[model samples]
Target chain A: MDDAPNSEHFTLSPIGHMVSDYPDKFGIPRQPGLAPAANAKLVLAAPYNDPLAVRGLEDFSHLWLSFIFHQSPQRWSPLVRPPRLGGNKKVGVFASRSTHRPNRLGLSLVRLVGIDTQQGVVLALQGCDLVSGTPVVDIKPYLPWAESQPDAKAGFAPQTPSLLAVSFHPAALDTLTQRSDSATLHALIEQVLSQDPRPAYKQKELASKRLYGVRLRDVDVKFRQRQQGEATTLEVMAIEPYDER
Target chain B: MDDAPNSEHFTLSPIGHMVSDYPDKFGIPRQPGLAPAANAKLVLAAPYNDPLAVRGLEDFSHLWLSFIFHQSPQRWSPLVRPPRLGGNKKVGVFASRSTHRPNRLGLSLVRLVGIDTQQGVVLALQGCDLVSGTPVVDIKPYLPWAESQPDAKAGFAPQTPSLLAVSFHPAALDTLTQRSDSATLHALIEQVLSQDPRPAYKQKELASKRLYGVRLRDVDVKFRQRQQGEATTLEVMAIEPYDER
Candidate 1:
């Protein structure tokens, strides 16, 4: 274009950091709302924590969070294979919501529960698929009138990913029964496993099953696939404290 | 909170920029899709323009552009008066989608028409409410199933903005007849004027009607409020060449 801006780039400071249910990227859902048990909150710092900055925010039920893929490698690739496409066919980074893209920027639509201003600006959120400690740059109320479109065409990823049946092994069930927060942990584990957290390549090789573990909260959840007749169930083998080093 | 990432900030480079029907910010719609005639395109540069970067993008009907509000002032205010709230009540910057936010970052959802690879990657888009020369940092295909929620609650802005009735003066109609692209210009003008481009404060002071001009393309569109009893119509008084200096 003849009138493009001369300044090619700019810098921004993180307004705060996230505290989410997913401890790492390994098991996080590919998209928000895929795991409703995945709760989160943004803990503001320094100049951004003023209560007045969040005044009248409760009226909005959802918000758009602009965040950074801080954990992804800084180097970016033009084309990437999305897990939704079976991690086989290559698509542009922009075509697929891959973390390996220019600028490493990301967007997540999360439900707004409420705000806690006792210690500072702590925004309680739900259905966020981000890893804990991710950097958040900006937050904007979701304008449903302008944003919501039921008839939109979503190419390769047409619908929510199909779920895999989940069950617990005897030892894992025994461990859950001993914990006070068993219900919460159980629900979180069910939500995480149903989405099948295995790498895309492994997801295809269902016949040769193996153990896979992902850190959720403070426990490492180990699970493997069990096929019986026509149905396949992802059975949780064990849940051990992550500090067992 | 104990696991918050220590890294506080980062920098980014603009992968592309915008060329749109909106020449300036004064008359631009507050949100995307408010004015469908507000067409636009993104001109990508350098490594970002590789055709491989946009492969498989054609399948998706819409995209989200994360851009910098380069035209807005660098400084930010904690409180802002949104036109939706009658411009009297103040809300926190985050609570409202005002241009003067902390990072000056904005998100726009635009319909993708197609891509042009004659020179570099040029994205043809529609329903964009951003000004020309916008610095776009990232582009992601819109996933409707997760994002579309008609039931979500919107605080201040609950619906599409109401528009005033529009009509053209005799002189303005005469000018339109001489233009080769009269149909395109006519549709653009009607879409813009009906939204009532006057500042929020002036919108309420309807009785003291006066002339207002906004630059669209290479023409200066002059208009004013006309209250005919219970009906209030915005009348276009003139359409003169933009370079009248």
Candidate 2:
């Protein structure tokens, strides 16, 4: 018998597309489980929607999602700047979870909230960093015993990044209160801003006045940062309906 | 602009093939790290063999390998009988790390022992559960802080499977002593058999005498089980070269 198996290339179609709260990639959390209020749904495609495909998925509390970094640049480099490493030092692409890979594939672990099999299989997920409409190729249940290694040493990101204090002005709070889904919007803003979504170099600058806006659902959230001694504060300036034409 | 991303399919090619000690699937460990003595190498293919593809990978102690379960059966069932569950109780295919799935993909975490870039890039791996000739698609460094969750609960496989005691017959030990790599061969047999690689149902049977043989490298290892009160002992009867014609 031949010792070597056949060497062949394979192709796969997207199994589903994720509908997430973040309309664009900017301000998205670096990893899942960082923003619990951010929820998404994986809407299955034609042939993959059968309930049989996900029969025992509910037993697993978390899942591994193999997705495409659709919005990232197409070309790949040997080294990349990781946001966790302050985005200045270049590390090997394989070492850092950069988007520009030979294959634009991204792996994420997300909490599995529920699965709807009524019309089709719609997977409810929480704490996802993927932007809205990300194409997901494969989904596998996370096996904690086999996958987790709590004592293993982490090279660069040894601990979770410190969070910035977030507060909204009365004008922004009043606008959020008038919205039908006020609680979700309020939590989404707090979750997004607490991560201090700014360029790594810009993060250290104290009191530099620059307003940033991130689109979430049908709203535009405007926020600014201020230096408070050792800690940074994110203040929500306004919240208004996003105009698209 | 529409918030939804373009729905498109993606294709991937095998980056390399694993050269493992176990020629067949039966004696392979159920998970990695079960048999640390067993080693394998991923010999890179064209294009992927470029050293730049794996630059800085040595910095990581472990890596996540996405591979194909090429030798598994073509069809899959929603419910699969896991050996951990004694092969009687059926659970969702996603819940268990069954080889058969909608896609023939398998994921494993292996220790990076070394990398040979002299002729072509060959990645030396330890504690691999993959069978020989398995196709590997992608390799990513494992970040312990993000990937490891020591506190996470494991549903079915909560702890390492119990090991069976093993002993060698006088005749078998003499035959192994004549081999050039006797030390390695001895350790291989002991490591492989201690996992009790029998069918889950057969494990409970007290004294049913059945001889079994497994092929590793260029040799065939024969062993039989004998019950010792509550524990089972595997006695190696013989070790001979595996002939291929």
Candidate 3:
């Protein structure tokens, strides 16, 4: 028998790369801007390094990011169960935000913090859920006038996410105090863990584990998952910024 | 050896069917809303017949329609040349609106003319570029407050399409006059032909006697291509409604 034919291929050059504190996907928020204090940086590629590219961008409080899901495997399926739908009901992949798609492109709206053009081009952004080292395909300044709709229907994910009440362990708090920017680090950690970023089904299995630690933005986030009747709770243990060895 | 695996083993039950005056693909505006007078109808499926599902739709003047490119062949390439980009420069299939896709789903924004709950939950739409039998998967009301961005940057395709000047033959005008709704029919015919729907690089052979005809809505348009000074021109010969035998 003859060898099977290989599918066609193409190369995509990233316009920029994302640098965030979250090195792995395990604890990253499901959607960008879900954790407001989670900051990330954008390092522009050559030829795109012109400061003029970012001119008039600072006026906008937020920006839209177009990026590739470079890590997702190539195989695809027609249907995918969305985590937002409790991961039980099956829906067409095109109707849901599943990483397994015909094309692995992803679009996310992120908050723009600050831009620095002095050394190449670095954009400081907050609430960036992208994993560290993720390649950004394109970035455009967001027009709030055209994008904000208070009355628009959100379909199944209509309910706004609830704010979680959290408390930190005294020891974990001590580790954070040793950092120069302890307040900022503490706030960032609290914001992320409070959202209960774990996969929905995973909650039942991890119920007995009192302390959960996640390393993000060069900090170790220790938290405890508790249950008060029907309500699920997450208590922050401590946020300690890593020390360079 | 075992029987070869079947590559084409799938059936799609259309969630709903689209009925547009654009009986054929040729000369339909490349983008919807370009021809305001053009209208179409959508008929939903059995289980989706509840009128209550459309309760909050009246507030929006437009909508996002997710549909399948049922006419396109099932297989696809990784890259495709977009007709909007002059059909020479190749872009990833995901980036172009080319029908050949891993999953042949299409997204179009169309103007909502009106909704009729009394008659089988039908929705009348204007400026729809979809063909008559296109299958619609889902419909979401367009929130202009969150969607319209005059300042937002568009890649490849500019916000407004370039327009071309057109002239029709007297014979074609005479034929159109004999129709019951001649005035409306002529206006619709002129709007469609002016868009220059011919494929790029289609003039490969110079067969002087050949005439091309495009069927639209309730009319048949016959035209001949000719050179006039520095520009190519289409000389219309006749416009008649399709006579079903």
Candidate 4:
């Protein structure tokens, strides 16, 4: 294999694109399954349109999505600094789930809500971590019996996220109230922004910015940033639903 | 990134070599952590032997080994047929844990029993699944709290393996009985071989072979193939301890 060094390249075409309410990368949970109400729709491509391909899928409550981080434009390094580890300690790229790699593949387990085959093929998913319009290569049904091992230990991320008392500004709540499924959308926005998604190093720049907004599906979510020493405080600004051109 | 397609290529060097009892790949488990007692040692290269590099390593009981599969001489395909899935159902290479990948980098979590820094760093590990002389590019301590998700679901693999009664021929037992800690070695051999490590398609040629031997550590394990109607069996032949020339 080492004799011919140039003979190992391969390519892949995305089978579909994931359309999620998440329009930006910053506020999406660092991990999937953290927000169960964040909805996304996977629109499948043609020739792979066979409805039979999705048979026995309804039995699974979640799926493993194999995807590519097509946007990352960097070469892989043997070692990487993970954000979860404070981005100072260097760990092997394989050990950390870094987007940069020899191959840019990313795997995330997301909740499967339902499937629609009427117009074409669409898989409704929740707790999606991908940005809107991210390409999806493949999906496999999650097998609970084989996948779950209750005895396994987790290292740095041992603490389950402490539930916070979330509140929204009156203006932001009014703006969200005008949308369909306003309650669901409000909960998602609150849950995501509350996690303090800014890079750890950017904590200072974020503190002074009073109004920060993220464009989501038909909505421009605006929020205010507050700093309590090292931790961040977020107050909702307003939600502007999408307006057609 | 698209403008400079050829500029993305990079090279890696082996930081160390893996020395395992299993000299060949024929009977090795498809994945590590399957057989916990199989041991191996890693010999580290110079320059990386600065005692400071291995600081804080003894805290973990296992490590994540990043290595290359230097044997298989084939280009990768987008899809591969996994032997565990009967080799009939084709799954994307990314979805299945197949060795044939665009880049043949392999990752295994092995039990780290000891780390000797005094003499050119030696890592004694258990549950090693690599073939003898495999080139290891990097090693990082496995943080169980971050890496292990007992609640996570596996995709297609069944939760529990079916029961099978395993026994060795009297002659084979006699040969193994001569070794120190023969009980552990016997159990390791039985557990590994019983998994039927042969390729799914090799049944036709394998059926006629009466005797097969695997060399590991200082022993040559010889066994005979038995078939009862549809069921297959492995009868032990002889265990010849290695004699260094």
- Scored by lDDT, the top model is 1
What order do you get sorting by TM-score, best first?
1, 2, 4, 3
Off by over 4 Å in 4: A1-17, A41-66, A73-82, A85-95, A100-105, A114-124, A133-153, A202-209, A226-232, A241-245, B1-25, B40-156, B174-185, B198-220, B225-233, B240-245
Question: Using alpha carbons, what is the TM-score of model 3?
Answer: 0.56
For candidate 1, report its TM-score. Answer: 0.96
Off by over 4 Å in 1: A1-7, B1-7
Tell me the whole-model lDDT of each prediction, alpha carbons only: 0.87, 0.80, 0.64, 0.65
Q: Which sequence of candidate numbers ranks them by DockQ, best first?
A: 1, 2, 4, 3
TM-score of each candidate's B chain against the true B chain: 0.94, 0.94, 0.86, 0.87
Clashes of each: 0, 0, 3, 11
Compute DockQ for each candidate against the true complex: 0.70, 0.43, 0.07, 0.15
Docking class of 4: incorrect
What CAPRI-style quality would you assign to candidate 2?
acceptable
- Model 4, span B185-210: residue lDDT tens: 88778767776665667544546675
In model 1 chain A, where is the ten-residue run with the lowest total lDDT?
A: A1-10
Per-residue lDDT of model 1, residues B1-245, tens digit only:
45433445678888888888877887887788767776688999777999998999999999999999998998888788988888899998889999998889999999999899889899999888888888899999999999998888999888899988889999999999999978888888898888888888887675856899888867889999898676778999999986632
After TM-score superposition, the amount by which residue B165's alpha carbon in candidate 2 deviates from its true location, in angstroms, is 2.3
Task: Tell me each candidate's TM-score.
Answer: 0.96, 0.88, 0.56, 0.68
Alpha-carbon lDDT of model 3: 0.64
Tens digit per residue, CA lDDT, model 2, B68-117: 78898767776788898899987766566788765667788888889888
| Candidates 1 and 4, the one with greater TM-score | 1
Off by over 4 Å in 2: A1-7, A204-207, A228-231, A243-245, B1-8, B204-207, B243-245
Predicted structure 1: lDDT = 0.87
Q: True interface contacts reproduced by each model, as a fraction?
A: 0.75, 0.39, 0.03, 0.08
